[model samples]
Target: MPQPSKLHTRFVRQLLPLLVLAFVLSAASTTWFTHRSQLAQAQVQRSQTLVTLGAALVKPLWDCDGTTIQAVVQAMTDQPNVRSVLVQDQCNATTWQAGTQAQGPDLHTLTIPLLYYASTGRSYSVGALTITFTGVSVRTSLTHNVGLQLVVFATMLAAVLTGAAWVFRRIIGRPLHRLREAMRAHQELTPIPAHWAEELAEITATYNTQVQELRRQARHDPLTGLGNRTLLEEHLQRAIRRAERTRALGHVLLLDLDRFKPVNDTYGHAAGDAVLKTVAQRLLSCVRDTDTVARLGGDEFVVLTPDAPVEGSIQALAQRLRNAIEQPIDWNGRALQVRASIGVAQLLRDGTTSAALLASADAAMYAHKQQDR
Candidate 1:
């Protein structure tokens, strides 16, 4: 199956980072809430412990010394992880006589009502004991909502940032780089890059295959599969361009079959077409594939040669074209002979347009036709 597009791939690439960040944030939020709940538990635990300690000294409240009270306070504060502990007596005079810890604005306080009960009825006693929790151990896991929120926000932010970079580099960057290198290699007409995506490679393969067909069509005739006028023009254009740019030698020959009209009139249009096909084959056999042989329609044709010596070479090509066409050919096993009046033209630097060059060759061919007559 073909892979998804680059756009979809990039989206998937970006989406993975977000998913990881979301997972991390969810875990972090769970952790933070768990910690918050633990803090609440700690609050309840300390308050209950203070109530027990305060209940012990109900009758001896009036006789309690600051030193004795401070001892209880010290003991509660020294309990493992407890930061500070304070206790208050119910009596209006003896309240708050525990713990040496100083109070901060961030303290948490819990109050418990004290009652004395007889078998007959319950009686209200000294009021209440207030336990204040503001100490070094708590460390303000949450302060005014902002501190806890900031910490959580920072964690999620870091995870997102790091995830974005990692996902982009791994998923998007590497593949995109490979794609770019493949495009460069294709532009240079070099071998396809190994790292090229399979889908892109398939597309390139299809495109190059179609291009090869188009190139073949451009250089070969549609009906007879021989070189056509367009092929001749292309080579002629290239030769002219090279002669101008690189000072190269170039020549073009125009050949018109002689006595071709009598064959067409005596045989038929089909026979005429066969004769043309036969002539094209002979012309093809006369020169290298590098040399272009083109049919300018009817009995007219042109041959183009580049890098050939100017003086003798152009005349020789003209003579060869004439001889190739004059040779006898078998059409459906019927033998026939044809002749061509050949004209030769040499191209100079910045010389002539294809039309003008062919016109010159045509005029020369007409001159030869008259001489042959």
Candidate 2:
């Protein structure tokens, strides 16, 4: 089984940025917020020392003595973060005593907690103070700000990701899909047109040009630039179809040179090649444009006629081929007489395959060579 593809790319392309943003923003806000909270706690701790001082002087507040209250309040002022303390009666909410720093006596009626005596039932009454302090407002502000910021950030992130996905589909996905379709079309077609997209158009055009070149190569003889085997096969198949439809005869003439090998051995392979080329040119001149004469190999060639073959037509074609090849080929102040043997085969469709026809024609040509020798 193939391994499953991972969505790791989804994580990198989409989720990573959102997560990093959230982490960075959260860390920064939480750091400042935690600092402010700690600072407020520290301030609260400092003020808490005064609560201890007021509680210690409870005996004095309970009608015990002034000296005790004064001593306690004075001691609190000396403590590290303590400012002042005022013991007040809970029932009347009146200050019993104020510290040295608690100048002007009443301190506009300070409301620190005080423990007092009850005469009738012999019970105690305690007072509570409304104290003013710092750091509370700072901590509250931070809490509100951080909560609101996080909510806004989360909403904005969702919107951004949604927009990014939409753009990716529209801009990247659609264009890439179109380009792929164009490539597939080119692959399926014979003559791949210049369907290369704007970006890859030149590349596709080059491929199309290559395809055309390949077709030309398939149809032409490499040695003489004449029709090759593929073209010959096409011709024979078409001629068969034409004969079946119209009741006309078709002929394919196969030709091979007589004593051509001796010339090649005496003069060299280069001279032999030139002689074949010359033979091709002569055959081309002898036949009409509609007729095709092509070199099958070194000393072998074929001519295809789509129409009816007369009784003497085959011999006439052979004579032309022999005369054409016998012409002089001059090289190095020496004139060479080129020569070739010819054989003819007439085609009858008769449920015959292309390969069968070519093979029979080749056998007929070899027989002709035997007769000539």
Candidate 3:
């Protein structure tokens, strides 16, 4: 059976890839928006700056002052990312031009016209200024900003996942581990403390109910309410391992109820069931609390003594069991008497394995029945 913590861990592992994908998509969206906004702002700022520079050249251009126009054009071209500047007269004549033409398609261009007014208040275009901006510096800065944002986003994502893992461990994983331990120890199923998620509580309740039912059916015999053959084998194996470690003796006793078929033949299965229940109670009273008594099948039972006494004391124990089985049982005001033939096998003497020891005891039981015959 898998522990609850392991299941929780597995669930988290399955969710991690989705979480990372979400983070990546969110980051991509953020980067795209930020880049576009930065580019838009840079274009606006560059346009405004060029308009101001163009306004400064209006007076110098209208006067047709060559030195002042050249000085103004040189200042505009010297500004960072200013690729080219052109000034054209009202007659569509190029008067002043500086810097090379823009190299690539990635450029921001702005055009501003200079208006000259006559004494009659009519305005006519005297010249126009055209400026082209290269986007190389802007793109470089954007690249740097994107790198920084990636680092920040990655760090935040790590911290968020780490916190989530810790919360899951404390709230879900630990509770599941406790539940698993309780189940393994065969303790009463207690309701786990409520979690923040109602669904988790419902799932836990359902799981606990199913596990309890399964354990009950697996380990117990329905008829006598005693340990079943599966439980017997488990207890037998544990007893053998403990005996080997401690160098102590253990015993397995396989018993067959003598003349049990006659009871079924005389009074039917109901009367035989009563006899079996009564015999099971009697067997319980014959041994210590540490020992285990199991029903293997019809008319057959086994007892496991984890710490058996010496040979004489062990024989006495077996004799007591036989006497208990021979005692008369009253079922529905009718008295029923039965006898048991028991076979004995000792740990390290008969065999080490549960299968070997059970076989030896089975063979001894047939031998005892033959002697009685």
lDDT of each: 0.68, 0.66, 0.83
TM-score of 3: 0.56
Candidate 2 matches the true fold with a TM-score of: 0.52
Model 3 bad stretches (over 4 Å)? 1-16, 90-94, 136-144, 189-191, 195-221, 224-260, 263-373
Model 1 score (lDDT):
0.68
User: Which has the greatest TM-score?
Assistant: 3
Work out the TM-score per prediction.
0.49, 0.52, 0.56
Scored by Cα lDDT, where does model 3 land? 0.83
Clashing residue pairs in all predictions, respectively, total 0, 5, 0
lDDT-based ranking = 3, 1, 2
Best by lDDT: 3
- Give me the runs in candidate 1 sitting further than 4 Å from their true place: 1-231, 237-250, 257-281, 295-300, 307-316, 326-341, 348-353, 368-373
Residue 55 CA displacement from its true place in model 1, Å: 10
Please give the TM-score that candidate 1 achieves against the real structure.
0.49
Better of 2 and 3 by lDDT: 3
What residue pairs are clashing in model 1?
none
Q: Residue 166 in candidate 3 has what lDDT?
A: 90
Write model 2 residue lDDT over 1-373, tens digit each, in one string. Answer: 9776543456446775766688577757775877677666766665565466556766665664656655765565565533454455543445544334443321222245454556665646565533322333444556656676667667766776677667656655554465467556644233333433455445446656766787788888887888888888888888878877887767777788887888899999888877777788988987777677877777888888777534366577678778888889877778888677666666674335556766777787789778877
* Cα lDDT, model 2, residue 65: 61
